[model samples]
Target: MDEEKKGTVHYKGAEGGWGSVRGITETWMREVDRPGALRTLERQNKPGGFMCVSCAWTKPAHPHAFEFCENGAKATLWDLTSRRCTPQVLGRHRVSELKTWRDHDLEQLGRLTHPMRYDAATDSYVACSWQEAFEGIGRELRAIDPGSAVFYTSGRASLETAYLFQLFARLYGHNNLPDSSNMCHETTSVALKKLIGVPVGTSVLSDFHHCDAIFFFGQNTGTNSPRMLHPLKEAVERGVKIVTFNPIRERGLEVFRDPQSPAEMLHLKKPTLISHQYLQVRAGGDIAAITGLIKHILAAEEKLWAEEQRHVLDVDFLEQHTEGFEALKAHVAGVGWDAIEAESGLSRADLEAAAQVYVEAKNTIVMYGMGLTQQVHGFENLAMIVNLLLLKGNIGREGTGCSPVRGHSNVQGQRTVGISEKPELVPLDTLAELFGFDPPRDKGLNTVEACEKILSGEVKAFIGLGGNFVRAVPEREKMEAAWTRLRLTVQIATKLNRSHLINGQVAYLLPCLSRTEVDEQASGPQTVTMEDSLSCIHGSVAHNKPASEHLLSEPAIVAGIAKATLPPNPKVQWDEWVADYGRVRDLIEQTYPDEFAQFNERLFTPGGFYRGNAARDRVWKTESGKAEFTVPDHLSAAGFEDAPGRYRLMTLRSNDQFNTTIYGYSDRLRGIEGTRDVLLMHPDEIAAAGLKEGQVVGLKTDAGDGIHREVGGLTVTPFLLPRGCVASYYPEMNALVPLSHHDQESKTPAAKAVPVRIVT
Candidate 1:
């Protein structure tokens, strides 16, 4: 906590109005000149412009003139910042000295202008030629057993880059392709695939317009995906009911004022009220909350059955399109209202009210975010939501379906193009036939597994396409130590991050062009494609010049390393593929012909093309060939009943940040300012813990895994969080979350529901 900085201020208004304008303007001015900012802004998300490097929220069919959001503007300007990290900059600072700087400070050091290699003798990074850097990485990767090498990717990667990176990893004889999705939406993929036969949301952005009722569970759209507010605002104006479920009363879901609209921004129009009904569920209580709603609906349907009246459950859809309804109905009926009320932090009346809204709506959409997925029973939470939807036949119908609002621009695209650690999911036979090499069949390591492997010395080499893996993953100290154990670590990035600071015995930083920079190759300026949260594949072309002449496109960087590592195969032309990304798409189409047919042709279409979801078409691809209802044996709240003064802590992103990238010290929407070192708690809980507002405290996990896990110097603040539930900024509080504490089925870290004790 900086004494000179101002204390937190409670903002009393809606999000995304004048405040967003100010934020975007301030970020743009601080990073780039007016001309550069204007140039970037004009082309953002437009035809021949770059895709937003932030959330995966899909673009509208008809995008606005200013299509970007406040956070999007920050991301663009941050990438196109004039500040450069040249050789002189590296020469001025040692690795040890750089490690002392904060994460945001390190990022502000600006973009890496050239490739650099760690020199032990000099104790600093020395500028290296592209050829030498690639060959050195190639030699090191080849020296290790391919199975011992882990290739990781961030969601920021383009489809072409992801395809090439995965292809390179496979050709080298391994499938250890872990990605950021493993940490974020892997639970959604796993649960949705198991229940609905697809690993993505069934509904598109257009569904928001026609849906009679929208249920938002544990998502903060205002900060995470601000652009989503537009449709939400429209839905509100159209008199559609919007219901929200979360521990915190997020201002974004409550109300929003469109900054892009002149009447709202210039004339100071009234903010659009968002959620018609808001239910505050306890942390890790999403399963219980959803189950409670289902329980209420089931009870209502049973009453109607006893009376021989009209039923709420879509009996026709259930009989024709689904299975196991009786089992689900029985399970819900057995769960008492007392347990549901205690676990979900909602009364029977409240749950019944929500259930009534669901029953009355002709069509409904359930949208969720990381809040629902980053918990111990995350998979179960998703399953319950799907069960509710299935009861109403919400699958594959217009204005009705499940939507998981994803983070990152191309996370879905990366997974769609085969960036998976699971070898069984990869089209091994198709890949072998297309590339003329036998693909590895062994299941590889996911993010958590890769970290453990590195710690145990099972993995010797680590390559990251993008993302600050150190700060992004749990068990931060352990992960940093694991990196040092790696024989070689390689990062392909646009800017400096903490991951680069945490180095291996042999470390390399390969500078790559940002999404906003033109990726000119031997053929011509290449356009890369991205899949939004809704699975819409759209082309993104960069009109701006490269940030640095030395910087290479991610595809080119991957190609260079692949060429250096593998022997020439006449069947695969790495150089040609790098020169023209269309060739990469051709291969992807061939690999998943039915799904990606006409991939190149569709890239040119306005607003791009949809990769048809079978579930969306009511075409169930499950073993039974029908949508199956899953029944949870038990739903447990994540808190200690015996441990006194214990709080259920959830890690959240501030409005000033996106993922791990800290844009500023202020979270204006939450009224937090000047510091990220604070905990949000209910006033009653603060009194119960004998803590005063603004008092510094320490948080320690009760995991007691022999490893000491604690984060100190956190200021406590009273907010509207549920009792026994507390919130803190992520990455800062990531240390409190144990690596072993994860969702059982998906292996995704349970970052949202860590039980901890507060220390005065």
Candidate 2:
């Protein structure tokens, strides 16, 4: 390697240089060691030990071995590494010095060994005991109006922990639970809630095996969920037509060499999983492209009906199970071909081609992620996709449905077990009946709402269960300012990060046992339940030791805080529940009896269980008892109405990352070996703008909130993205995201479609 390349360091690498990096190699080696400090803890068979802290995607109960992904390994290394974040050590470092460290460096500093309170007087943090931390939080929280407290939960919080958190918040007389899901898949929930009734993903892992054609739009399965590689590869072998619609070409989408495949592993090669038809659709233009596909499908159906007397849509199913077809048809008719082509950057021919593929396949599945969900009209964009699938009667079938890929393993699970601050009338009523108290009827704040409340001085306390909430929110200035205004900020996490540094007036950083650590109670080794991407709920008992003696499981932490904060709250036995997680599960069973039946018995099963819902059989959970189509309107409206030099930019997670967890700086598929600073753009556009490859340039957007921030030192690279779309890594460019810029219905920031221009 060249000297420059050897010394190179950037935001986070975009591509495959994981093996050669010294720091990463050391971490990997440390991860493999057993019998030593790393191995001593990793090999023990205890509840809550050695859970992959990366993406919430889980393996189907393999023989007690290394069941973690690369990102998961990094998360484990982060918790168990030799680094320590002692109060005195951190106190020595100034706020500016701490701020100077990279996001990766801050997190790499090992476990927060003691509860620490950020002391603004000395501009440093000081050690505090668990009692002191809890008492401080309780005192501050008690002083604030209950409605002014914002409780944030990450997917990493176990089902027990999440339930107790909601209980604590409700008992405290508020429902302001902001979570990571709002930033990722809130659009899917909003669209599905209005159309199909269910606010969660319905697609099962088994559906991947049955689907005759899988249309993966706006998602990179390899980077997001590595475990998906096996199923996709199997589908290809069975002749399932795989189609991908993404701006950049991802290697995992093209082909994957499964290490588990003995034959392929011995050959040192991988099988191809490329899309039979690849469409590099423009960012924010997904709705137009989907609408065009639907139009083509309708056209083909009409032709088939005229000649062969065959209907493309399932007339029986449509008549029995859906409504609003006429309105949807009218909207589709109004969408002109010229507008579709111009907005989506795909020709009518490409739309027709994709439609033909969908039409020919017997069982089709459509999977998408933040790419489709983080747009201005994201909710409507998802509705159109559902409309396309529904036109062909694709949903609620043996092998056809929409799959919204959530980032965390138990994110959907979190919503399932009552992590939601937004209470549906039915659930709230049910909870009231079960718990003997009137649950808060008012809708709670989402991520954006929480920030707005915090900024306006309405929210005085911000308590996070387990996420980098400050870093995760957009427009850092407003968010940071609001956080500092809070009287109390508390984080219950396995390791320290930027969230701890950006403290409120009285902040406490409480370190807890990681998933890989032993979680014990009176019943001996305990097991926690997690929900996977496919809605499969299962038990996970760790086979490892605790990282440190002081560490506690998420459930224990929640219980501890609840014990200290709640003023003899009714309907919840915080101490008893903490004694054993099963009690929490029992309470959950009562609260959501329809889903978690025989919770204890079923959880013992190897794969745990699936929360059964009739919606899987196409029963619309909507108010009218039927799935409804939404009218597509102005998906690319921002682009058309905007002025010149405004390009739609999408922020993406690198292959080496999972949300805010940056393991290293490498993206294998994009061929970005060791840098995240390079922006992916069309060579033509870069050259036209008088910018050369590897040259740093500033980028500003004209999206409603007037975000004209400069992102200098950005290296440009030529990629296969559509002309109107450009790509950059997230958190780095997260500052460019305006807080006011969000989906109308879902309130999710349009991180994928901000209009911007390159500056000198």
- Estimate the TM-score of every prediction: 0.97, 0.93
C-alpha lDDT score of every prediction, in listed order: 0.86, 0.74
Q: Which parts of model 1 are misplaced by more than 4 Å? A: 1-9, 305-308, 637-642
Q: Candidate 2, which segments miss by more than 4 Å at Cα?
A: 1-26, 30-51, 61-67, 266-270, 433-436, 569-571, 635-642, 704-708
lDDT of 2 at 33: 44
Cα lDDT of model 2 by residue, 1-760, tens digit: 1131222222222222232234335566654444354453343222233345567554453323434444555555655566666766677787757887888777766667777787888888887778887787887878878888888998877787888788788877788877888888888878888888887667776788789998888887767776566677778888998888886666567666554455654555544545677787888778888888888888888899999999887888778888998898888888899999988888899888888988888889998988888877888778887887788788877788888888886787788877776776237776666666777878888999988888888888888988898888887766786678788889887667788888888888888877665688776777777776767677766656676666777777777777777777566677678788898899889888888889987774544467865667777878899988888767472333545677888898876677887766766555676778877777777777677777777787566555456676788876666786788988888777888778888888888887777877
What is the alpha-carbon lDDT for the whole of candidate 1? 0.86
Q: Write the per-residue lDDT of candidate 1 for residues 37-62, one digit (tens) a residue.
A: 78778778775677899988887657
Question: Among these predicted structures, which one has the highest lDDT?
Answer: 1
